[model samples]
Target chain A: MIGGRPDMVDDEHRLKMLMVAGLGGDEAAYRAVLGALARHLRGFFRRRLASRPADCEDLVQETLLAVHTRRHTFDRSQPLTPWVFAIARYKLVDWLRRHARQDALHDPVDEWRNDLAVEGGQEADTARHDVSELLGTLPAKQREPIRLVKLEGLSVVEAAERTGLSVSAVKVGIHRGLKKLAAQFRP
Target chain B: MRTDDLVALLARGAGTEPMAVPARVWAMAVAGGAVAAVALMALMLGVQADLAGKVSTLAWWGKAGFTLAVALPALALITRMARPGSHVGRLPVALAAPVAALWLAAAIQLAGAPPGERLALVLGKTWASCPVWVTVLSLPLLIAALAALRALAPTRLALSGAGAGLFAGAVGALVYTLHCPELDPAFVAVWYVLGIAIPTGLGAAVGPWILRW
Candidate 1:
């Protein structure tokens, strides 16, 4: 049922082509595949982690790293979606297991259902807090541009102007900030 | 970090990174493990004095064939499990086939033997030492295969470990055949199978911890 849809088939074909090319050392194709996968993985994690939306991006990054590092395991002849999603599913399960253990330690069994039922506004607030906390971990040079360009939706030029940095510096800040954020979840 | 940034970073290293080919990795593991196991068997137990004579016999071929049949399917199972979401379709059945065939042969052999000799046929001369030897010999292959699995991605950690163990154990038994003189079907059906099972159990038990990414 997964690849039965026409659009799904197109995605499968396109992604498989990109993945194959990527495996053959085509960096652009590799980047394109990862970019497309990021969109899909964001949706996948968001749906699964609805109760803890703050964790979706972390899980997405983790799965993306797993996919990138384990790309060699992918059979060139196979469809790309299942292989990619399988890693996603594994990361989801792994994340859930680790968090479940932590949740068990911090929260009583009686409050578990209530935690799951946290309302939308509260969830958004928590997500925002988590984003700021993540950004807070970066140095000012990286943090300010990431906040402005990524969180606050400023253009790179505007962020550079606001921070008194070159446009390239602002771009580098965002990139390095994002890289650091991804690395935080590595272990 | 934004997913886009992470993707960009990952792509930057793509062409420069050395990709591990699954087939090549596994082949090296199996080949290296087999060689190590054969050398270990030679050093520890020494080849049976009649190995040259035995190779031409049906019983020797049966033992080799049984171990091979099990090992091949187990290798297939582990290969399937190395990748996430890959089905191990019919492989379990294939792995079981040799044991079933051997057991059937053992039953027939027992039926034909005198009741007094039946126990001897089942126990053979080295019943206590056989399984133990097989398990010990499997260590190299188990370590090698698991190391290979570690380099790749295996989502079902325990199952993949068990597959590696099964493959290692069977290969171990195959190598053990170089030294084992007993050719009774029942003895192999029971003790050789036990030898393979030890590693399989060990693999399953340690899989979650060792195979963790």
Candidate 2:
């Protein structure tokens, strides 16, 4: 399958051919792999984080670089897509971690606060509707703990005290409740 | 850098070392470290005075055998982890079985022994320094493992580091056996495993930093 696919048309096969060639020291094939990978990563990150365009492009570039450096490690037995995307996933996580730390320390100036309020009304309404819909699906045991915890702003111990259950039992109920809610939310 | 520029850059290969197979790189790294550890041990901590006599007993072979057993899964884990997107699926089970088996053996030994003896068996003579020594010995191996990791890509840095550390710990224990006289399976099972765990913990702590591209 290496270098014979002059018109494979499939990304997976094309990528495999390019990787095989690149590892064999074909600069042209290696360049082709990067170009294709860059395009693939753009789509991948864009779908995952549509709100962050700059982050998406930056991540695409980082992932391509990583793939380039780590090309020798790509196992011939495995598919090309997973290896590429795995690097992308790591880059995304690192990016998220870096952004989280920066946000934690960089004081919020609130210059765009009013602008957010003006634009967020529709999104907030949808979010509120979705939350209630999701919360309504749970049983009383699970729902009550969630209400006490998330909705009522009570601590786990307080919620347990109010619910007449042991602390461990309350925690279990909360976990089970969230798990059920998550199942329902899955597409 | 722009994708075009990046491709052109890598294509140029300007002084970049030609990439080798991941397995070969890792094997060389770990193997080199093991040899270095052995050499260092020979120079700084010579073999115990009565290794030959102890070999006739269950202690010497028992320690060496057990250390090799623990090292097996760690080697398998690194083989898979040395590549990007390679799943570490159920590889942990491989690492856990030896520990769990040893622990079970220890518990059984403890159950049969007298209450006074059970305490002594669990805490061997060198409980305080065992972990520290193992950690120190693992540093060289860890560095080599980290060096090997640089050429390949690991998605889970911490997990990969832990694997490398565990491999080194097993190597450390293998070396420690040459000096120490403790023979009880219970002691080897617990303390030697603890020695290994120290490096694994450090690897987990530092992997994110060391393995970053």
What TM-score does each of the candidates earn?
Answer: 0.82, 0.73
Off by over 4 Å in 1: A107-187, B16-20
Top-DockQ candidate index: 1
Per-model C-alpha RMSD: 7.6, 19.6
Model 1 chain A: which ten-residue window has the lowest total lDDT? A120-129
lDDT of 1 by residue, A1-187 (tens): 8768999999999998988888787889999999899889889988887766657867777788788767778887688899989889888887888778776777576566655554433433122224567778899999998777666667678888999999888866765665566556644
Candidate 1 clash figure, as a count: 0
Tens-place lDDT digits, model 2, residues B1-213: 244554554444212224457767877988898888777777777778998888788656867877888788887887778787788788778778778877787888889999988878878787777667767777788789878876567778999888888888898888878777788878878788889998888887888888776
Q: After superposition, how far is residue B34 of candidate 2 from its true place, in Å?
A: 1.3
Candidate 2 docking band: incorrect
Candidate 2 lDDT, A91-182, residue by residue in tens: 88877887788668765765346335535543211211244466678887778777776566676788889999887676667656654553
